[model samples]
Target: MNEVANPGSSAVVLIGTAEYDHADVERVPSVSANLDDLYDALLDPGIWGVPAENITVLRDERDPASVYDAIRAAARSTRDDGLFLVYYAGHGFPYDDDLVLGLREVDPQFPDEKGLRYPKIRQATQLAIALRRVVILDCCFAGRAGREVLDAGDAVKQIAGRAEISAEETYLLVAVGPNELAKAPLNDRHTAFTSALLHVLTTGSETADPVLSIRTVAEKVIRRVVAAGHRRPEFRAANAAVDAPLVRNARLRPHDLTGVVLEATADVTDPELRGAVILVLRHNDSGALGVRLNRDFGPLPAALDGWRDHVSLPDRLFDGGPVAQDGFISLVRLREHEERPIRFTEVTGLLGSLPLSDAQQSARDRIADLRIFRGYLGWRPGALERLVTHGRLRITDTNPFHAAFARAPFTRTGS
Candidate 1:
């Protein structure tokens, strides 16, 4: 799960061209409303709730440098833990195998020279301090733009000498496939993709998850766009960012914390909890149960040493938390299509916990990953939520296993 970005520290830039000056380029009047409605959706408290002052909107702008400068300024201003989002709805075309955004005065035949090349936006995003970055494209050849922006294969040539941002932390959500044209019906108030997206963000989904995550929103919008006779949208996020929450769910109560990870904030001073990385095992009205992931408690006990081959990282038992220090919890990640092996109780996705009573019956071949911990972390009914609300324990919507290992793939300042 990926955590929602902190509103105060994040920035958003929206660019759209409703009326083109070039004779050969077609006008998309709906692009105007696309910007307006998206602005409202992003600012709504019930939705993502980004501050109005943090968003910059440029409509029918003739200067391409203004677009480039806005994105660069936003990226530079965002904090390391913040999120930066850039959205564009305009005419896009292929230029020398790259995507270019058409501005108000763009020449259809000379887009490479007259329009704004997407590499500039990508370069700006690549220099951001924000760990989570989003690019939403609503135009022709959007998929192509998304692909180039997310792909790191050409980062050296694109950025020249600047440090490259990790592609794993960036997300791309496009309105159409690489070969398809985005639908901007003259009869509709907004483009087909933007219309479906706005509907989901405003109405919320009926899914069990408490928050309307970025991936979930895309899934819901894709169905609507396809059903409405438009090209299918493409969403690409490779890491824990896939579960980043964008808004509160309007139709449901806050759900369980089975899949959530909670990282202690920088201000936390508790010796046992400060800088702790905890993975929630259960959560409900009663309380919450989790395990600390950053400590090791040496090798497994002699009686359970048989499973040592399957343990993750240092091949030792983890120091879960202060509670029930003698108890042991075994977690396993099942293979792609394997059935639920004996004693396995799923926590989320492919991860689950299994009792160690029958080692032989556990079916070793079905296991794709494993972790063992001693003790557990427990919190009273409302205590955990209060801590999170007060900023003591930051909620990170991410895969639990990422923090389970000794060293994670991405940089986690809190841990």
Candidate 2:
């Protein structure tokens, strides 16, 4: 995922169980899907800001202590900056005035000690070196996690239902009320609650609000679930210095785009798009198009290695875009040899599109930088210019060869 513009140190711990080895715990068919969706959402380059490498996922953990240990270590690891978030989607129950996350091996009769208490989580959140600590619990009767955050002394005996805990910088979201059941309805692929969460995170709707915070997320989720006639979602925030921003809305910039010669500006938020330089093959009022310069999509197929015989650069494919993913095309950087066929359009000095026939002919001369692209990016008439006007793209002249593979398309202004 793309790091926040000024994203501080961050860590994510995700735990979910779809089945339990113990017969006492009924399998929660949707927990696995919940984890899958959440993992992707947090890694969304345009939204959650949590990097894939910085995340830890425990799926159907057989060891009861491992999740807690990992969480403890993660809390310790995040010690004073960025955000630390823990997400749990599985079986859990209220215990001794607190909610305890259930282990996969949990024995119903001995369930009391088969998990960790919410107080332990609160303690970890407090001690975590991060600026913000977020706990998301998606399980039956799981709302106590929020209530206990505000008033730990109260023995939360029933569906602790969502507590309206006040906080300076509060962040906690629970799935159902104390007596309520979090349903993974047979008709749906994901639990109603988790599906609601995903919708708020990935929706394309425009919002004047700049920041997507826990408060805002809770509100959106509540609206979605209540409208569906499911149990209401709950949220509680303790004292906080500011309402933490989870993601910044994608905005466009106002600038002219020459297509090939332009850089993505501050307003672009297309995942790994901003600051990426692209090789523009076509551009005009009718439309504009290009492929990323720096995307090295692993090594090229063995047959294509012959095309790279002349250049010392690595032979790899570049992911052009998300459009035509099933098809493949080659962007050849030829040596402009006399023996080379003139059937392709030159994109830059020595670089152009290479036909499959010539590409397979074993060029009589060496090729410099030959790249295979899975797809290409395109824009409709006047759309490319509109993007620039809204700041989605920036214009700049750069050495097509070096910029395409060696450096950041543009120097970043912030994290």
- Across 1-415, the per-residue lDDT of candidate 1 in tens digits comes to 4345777678889999999888889899999998999998777544555778989999998888877888898888888667888999989888876789899999978887667898878898877788778888888888777454433324334445545434446777889877778888878899888899888887887776657777688888889999998888888764432356666664652356666888989878876687788888888779888888777677657776665565432445777878898788877777888788767788887787877665664476677767778888898765565466436888886667666543642222223
**Which stretches of candidate 2 lie above 4 Å from their native place?**
1-8, 79-81, 148-168, 248-415
Worst 10 residues of 1 by lDDT: 406-415
Q: How many backbone clashes does candidate 2 have?
A: 29
| TM-scores for candidates 1 onward, in order | 0.57, 0.61
Q: What is the alpha-carbon lDDT of model 2 when measured against the actual structure?
A: 0.65
Candidate 1 overall Cα lDDT vs. reference?
0.76
Distance from true position, residue 89, model 2, in Å? 0.6
lDDT of 1 at 69: 87
lDDT of candidate 2 over 1-415, digit per residue (tens): 1223223367888888788778768888888888888887766544544656778898887665666778888877774547788888888776665577777777656665666567776776666677677788888888767664542212132214435533324478888876677878885878888899888887723666645766567788878888888898677656433456665443322222432556777778876566566677776556677776655555667865564456544445667766676666666666655555467666665667776456445552545555667677777755565454335666666666665546233232211
